[model samples]
Target: MRNKNSRNNREVMKRILGCIRPYWFLVLLSLLLAVITVVLTLYIPILTGQAVDLIVGKGDVNFTGLLAVIRNIAVAIAGTAVAQWFMNHINNKITYHIVQDLRTRTFHHLQVLPLSYIDAHPAGDLISRVITDIEQFSDGLLMGFTQLFTGVITIVGTILFMLSINLWITLVVVCLSPLSFFIAGFISKKTFTMFKKQSETRGELTGLTDEMLGNLKVVQAFGHQEKAQEEFEEINSRLAEYSLKATFFSSITNPATRFMYAAIYAGVTIAGCFTVIGGGLTIGQLTSFLSYTNQYTKPFNEITGVITELQNSLASAARVFQLLDEPALLKDVPGAPALENVQGKVSLNQVYFSYLPEVRLIEDFNLDVCPGQRIAIVGPTGCGKTTVINLLMRFYDVTGGSISVDGCDIREVTRESLRTNYGMVLQETWLKSGTIRENIAYGSPDASEEEIIQAAREAHAHSFIMRMPDGYDTVIGEDGGSLSQGQKQLLCIARVMLNLPPMLILDEATSSIDTMTEIRIQKAFAKMMKGRTSFIVAHRLSTIRESDVILVMKDGHIIEQGTHESLLEKGGFYAELYNSQFAPAG
Candidate 1:
């Protein structure tokens, strides 16, 4: 496990560096500034030592020479400050730009990922990876750019300056520095595992919170507040535990390195004092060597801190890269023709599918429909009713057999073209945070104002929309903020009404609307389905009575098929289902 983790860490770092490659020029500029800053900073200690030498005795001091040395020191300090500022500015630019690029690529990759991948992952977890994890990575990378380069340069510069003063003292400082590195490295190796666990727990907590919040009403109605709280607390406790462990390990690194460095500083001091007494070094030179010792050790402290942060960053980066590495949807057939002028005809020949390979949910399903047919599919819950729509929409391709439209296999056509010809509205309504007009025009972005209003009127939503303060232009929040469920469903219906695609799939689309509104919408649907291929999946038996063909499914098989009246006469699964819904109350 340790070796595997080390390998993954190396790979994550390589990819991060690859992201920085595009901004090499800015990174180069920052490095140059870091060098200048370190060099000028180290030069200041030399000038201070010279001023110390001029102060030979209280009254024997060379005031003019000391003043000149102090002036030079001030100039060096000012130069260091200027270089540090520009370096920081450049680092900020590079860090944020890399962050922006990573976010963009991650989001874009999401768009192409197969629906199966999305269905298997929680929205909250994916969101945490994209937003929270990337932000953590950003903080780490920024710290790295700001300190890593400067710390390295400072360490090297201080060593060179000390060696020039006295080789023996420099060797002592250098020899003792490895202790700090060993301590820091030992602590950091343990932090990565803890931090990774913390990140995972955080994502789980986010997923649970989002799931609860998104369905807070259901949770409250079911009196599940306590249960939900318990689940949340469990995940939250794990997150806290992991976070504490990770933080504890990383936090100790600074002080631990500081202790080792203190020993190195004392050793250097003792060694320098003997050299000064033996006349091997002047008092001013000894002072300068002590200053170099402090300088050399400071970078070790800072670099250790940087290493801790980088471990956290790499953990987050590993999660992010894991997302990016998911297999994208298979590319559309090259040079495939766009599905245009679609006839309403569609055929499914021996189609098979399952959410899990070991457990089949749909198998060997076959169906054929002529142009201008209204097909209503009905079954008990989990009877593969919605799964049929998924296959038809190509959200999940059939594992075997094939589905074709107008005698052309769906897989041979561009997905954009295939999907564009079908308009779908599910039981759950979704509305973006926008004006009612914009929401209605979502399916048809270029739809004219008149067309949008006409679609809303047809869906029986115009009256309620006009009652809002802004009427058609009334702005709403995500998922139709403050709107009634029926109102949101009406808006979704209006969207499809605007597009009027050649094929339509209504999966319990009117479940949320009142009976009165549904009756009127049914009339509109009748008109819309007049010349289009329509597939209606509904539990309300009465709603599908007008369908040309009614399919009753059981365990992924079509057990009965016919018009509602004919199916009722058969007294089969279809009759039993219809009677169960509309049978006289006992």
Candidate 2:
């Protein structure tokens, strides 16, 4: 297990380094600055030691030499400060740019992922991975760049300076240094697993928070607040537990390394005193050696702290990479033709599909529709009503057989081309945070203001929109702030109305509107569907009564098909379903 984890960590590190490769010039510049800063910084200790030598006998001190050494020390300090500042600035630039690139790539990859992948994962969890996890990774990368680079360079520079003074003392410092590394390495290994668990739990907590907050109204209506709170608290407690354990392990690394370094410092001090007495080293040299000892050990303390943070960072990075590594939807077939001038002749033959491999949801489903037919699909809940529409839209490919649009297999056409030819209004309405006009013109960005108003008027939304403070220019929040569900649905309907495509799919498109408004929209839809191929999925049987062919489905198979009046005469599933909605109250 340890070996596997170490390998994973290395792989994550390699990928992180790959991201940094693009900004190599900045990274190289930062590194050059770090070296200069460390060199200038180490020079100050030598100057301080020289000043000590100049103060040979108090009254007989070389005041001029001491003054010159102080001036040089001041110059070195100023140079170090400047270099350090530039290094930090460059590190920040590199860290944020890499984060920006990662976020862009992750989001782009999300756009191409299959809908099945989306259906199986929680939106909150995916969101946490994209936003929160990447933020954590950025913090870690910045710390690594800012501290780790200097720390390593400082250790090496200090060692070289000490070696020029006394070999024995340098060896003692070097031998004891391994103890600190050993201690830090031991603790860091343990922290990695704990930190990984903490990150995963944090994502879970975020997911839970997002889910509960997004549907707070529903929770209250269903009286499930307490249960939801309990679930949240359970995940929160686990997150707290994991965080505590990880922090405990990581926190130990610093003090533990500090203790080992303190012992080395004491050892070096004692050895230096004997060497000075034996005339093996001058007092000035011993003083400089002690400073070098302090410098050498200081970085170990910081490096250990950085390692702890890096472990946490790698954990978050693993989650981010997991998202990026998900198998994206295959690219369009090479040389595939764009679906153009679509006449909306669609056919499904021996289609087989299932959300889960062991559970069959759709099997051997077949359908054929002429260019200008109105098809209504009615089914009990969970009977694959939406699945069929998904297949028609090519959101999910068939596991067996084929579906074609105008005799051209949908798989052979670019998805953008295929989707662009259809106007879809789902039961769930989504509106971006924008003006009403923008939302209405979403599908057709080039649509004129007059055309937008006409579409809204046809959808029976013009009156309500006109009453708003900004009228067509009123800006709305992400979920359509201060707007009723029916109003939001109207905006979505208006959006589709703005650009009535070659084919239409309305899955409970008017389900949220009032009966009066729905009646008006139905008249509008009648005009729009006059010569277009349309597929309507609805639970309200009355709405689809005029459909040329009504498909009654049960458990993934069509059990009945015909006009509503013809199905009512048969008194099968369709008649029973239709009758239940209009049946007299018991």
Q: How many clashes would you count in candidate 2?
A: 0
Which candidate number has the best lDDT?
Answer: 1
lDDT (Cα, tens digit) per residue for candidate 2, span 409-503: 99999999999999999999999999999999988899988999999999889999999999999999988988999999999999988998989
As a whole number from 0 to 100, the lDDT of residue 35 in candidate 2 is: 100
Per-residue error at 172 for model 1, in Å? Answer: 0.6
Per-candidate local distance difference test:
0.93, 0.92
| For every candidate, C-alpha RMSD to the true structure in Å | 1.0, 1.0
How many backbone collisions does model 1 have?
A: 0
Candidate 2 runs further than 4 Å off:
none
lDDT of 2: 0.92
